[model samples]
Target: MTGKSRAPNLMVFGVLLCLGLLFLVLPAYHAGNLARIMVLAVYAMGYNLLFGYTGLLSLGHAMFFAAGMYGLGLSMTGWGLSPVPAFAVGVGAATLASAIIGFLALRTRGVAFMIVTLMFAQAGYLVILYFGAYTRGDEGFVIQQADRMIAGIDLSGDAARYFTAFILFAVCFLGLAWLVRAPFGRTLIAIRENEERAQMLGYDTTMYKLRAMIVSGAISGAAGAGYALLFGYVGATFATVQYSIFPLLWVLLGGAGTLIGPLVGVFFMFYLIDISSAVTSAYMLIAGLALVLLTLFAPQGFAGELRKRVFAWLP
Candidate 1:
């Protein structure tokens, strides 16, 4: 690859290295926080693949997320499967769900698409509630610490959990960075910019979008599965609309279509709430104000703005 093509890979590696190093210095509390941030960053990155790159707006991603979570949770808790296999099942469930949803929802465009997704997600949430006998309803069941171990390593420990989250984030980050630089990624971008033109160019736009949904859902599902496995709890709350919106906020704030935007947005939002909550009960107000200012000043998002002004080479 040319130097220009190599830049994104180098940047991704550097970010992963820095994240790995940060664990050594971070306090246990902050380390735990970072772990959560990393997991959520994975979710935002998945959202970016569909919304940012493909220009498909989904308001019901929580169903796929919850699919992965409940897939893994129920597998281990009910069927007595191992963590690795359960995680795979969760990702698979998400992939399948996305494929089905994409086929149906992709038929509609714009606001109709968003509404369809939201309706599907709400239906999924209700299903979880209806099957309370297995899902445990709102009061989620906890995965015992003993079941959280992998190959004799205890993931419940601070260092182990942090490193695991870091590894998961790094893999997804680098993979996406590489993907967006690939030909398929370029096609998605083309479709995003102008679907009709892409179709005139002989591209199967619908197929590409369906594929994007599958990939996006798989990644989001992985994040959800990781969160449940690492944190040891899966609940109906994740299936709620708020969880779906969180990824959108992160992607928009970080810079949609930018490789590193998801992580930046997740880190920023997580700390914004963390710091604001300590000061007052009106944390949501503070967050809203911050978001408003960000939208007014940096319409393209934090990383998006930086890419526009400072780093044209940023992937």
Candidate 2:
């Protein structure tokens, strides 16, 4: 924010930009899958904004993600909107949904909060099920784009979509890092550390938590939109609890409060699953077992454990 900090910020941005460009050189198969992993990482970071930093464990982020995917899918397929506007609508819908659900969930805390969010998320999934005819029922809406909606660049192709996702992930990663270092973000951290103390110190803990939820929800939504566009489909499965828990696992495994931890977690878990699949039919079951073992052995998480033992100065 200050002139003295501009150089560091620029350098960080440059590093992120360079990292994004690296994807262009990756093999197509790796690039596409890595891009998807980056999207999931983004979603994890968004969840970390609240759950990790604000100490609010939400089980309903699927609600926001599903909103974004469905919104974009419907906009592009049913409404015939261009990519840009359709994506905007998707993000907006997720924002609206998060705001409404977060407002209600924030009224409770601990397990109560978690339950409320889950209930709302499940309700949203049911709505999608009920309106299956419009949303293509359980099969979902297939998105097909014939026009370039973003600056005349066609993002329908796999390579283009991968690059687009890289750009989004890079921007989000840096932006989220910046946000966590800001004053507002510090206040959220304070709330996480101790809500009573933060409130006593004149900070509006409730308001801060809500703000974090809004931002987190928006990022989650954006990730969802990017996934739908990249994959060219939006299904009700995106809204289910099965999907919601992935981000939680990612954040926890990565070291919930660490900036780049989510990225590491996504990379590790995604590839781990891939590797496990070649050897076993029940890949998820084995992965789950591995996770249980890892969690038990290293309670602080992968990044956290690394920081504690090797990199004491990790951010």
Candidate 3:
């Protein structure tokens, strides 16, 4: 609608073009790394919809992500479903899980709400881990060899798998870009700014929040499915609290609420980890130190601070 609002979309196009070119020029091994970065970006954007727009800070996003990953894996390995159907099964399970959690947690507010979500997510995580027969516990389960292919496309190939991730990321980027410009997205922002005021104005704040949670969960779930499909592995790590912090780190580093923030955040951290891993096994220590410095200096996040100082004139 305005120059300020359109800036993010323009940035998205530029970034995606750069990513495409990077994949084209880089070796397949490196390109696959970029593809994982794309999936992580999708995860961060989904979380941003709730944290950046609706002002909901959830620490249990791993529950939703794990739902999708395990859902797809189990569907294919145990239920004998094809790749596409298994993906849908994973997404649906995540959406439903998020809805249930949102419905129950919305009863509280602020700190209480955050704790409620964390508890629920933790309990679910434990259940998934203990039920080794279904999820194979920490070892995880892989998709059946027969169910790995979709129609004529051989997803076993790294190139095809990376392309699949690219397409999913591109479609999601476009969809989320359009969403933030729509009326529904605007309402989430309004709720975020002042929930009580929105309620006074006759908007159902709870319903809007629930919808945002479901949407966020579904998107994160889809990313999880893509991840399992790409790597052919679904493990307990994806469901842990440690993993949930990753998207938060990405969003804060790149700037929450900005459409391109997740992309920048993912690229920076992904490369940071990738490069650091070659030299030392303690790469996470390096990552943690960087995050600490970012917290001290750029607390508003890279994208948020950029807009405040440089792009203040933009929408």
Judging by TM-score against the true structure, name the best candidate. Answer: 1
lDDT values, one for every candidate:
0.94, 0.84, 0.87
Q: Which stretches of candidate 1 lie over 4 Å from their true place?
A: 1-3
lDDT of 3 by residue, 24-69 (tens): 7999888878888998888998998999878898988999999998
Please provide TM-scores, in order, for all candidate models, with all chains considered together.
0.98, 0.92, 0.95
Lowest lDDT sum, 10 consecutive residues, model 3, at 139-148
* Over 4 Å off, model 2: 1-18, 145-149
Candidate 2 RMSD to the correct structure: 2.8
- Whose lDDT is higher: candidate 1's or candidate 3's? 1
Question: How well does candidate 1 match the true structure, expressed as C-alpha RMSD?
Answer: 1.1
How well is each residue in 1-315 modelled by candidate 1, as lDDT tens digits? 498777777888899989999989988899999999999999999999999999999999999999999999999999999899999999999999999999999999999999999999999999999999999999999999999999989999999999999989988987898788789999999999999999999999999999999999999999999999999999999999999999998999999999999999999999999999999999988878978898899989998999999988898
* Ten-residue region with minimum lDDT total, candidate 2: 1-10
lDDT of 1: 0.94
The lDDT, on a scale of 0 to 1, for candidate 2 is 0.84
Taking all chains together, the TM-score of candidate 2 against the true structure is 0.92
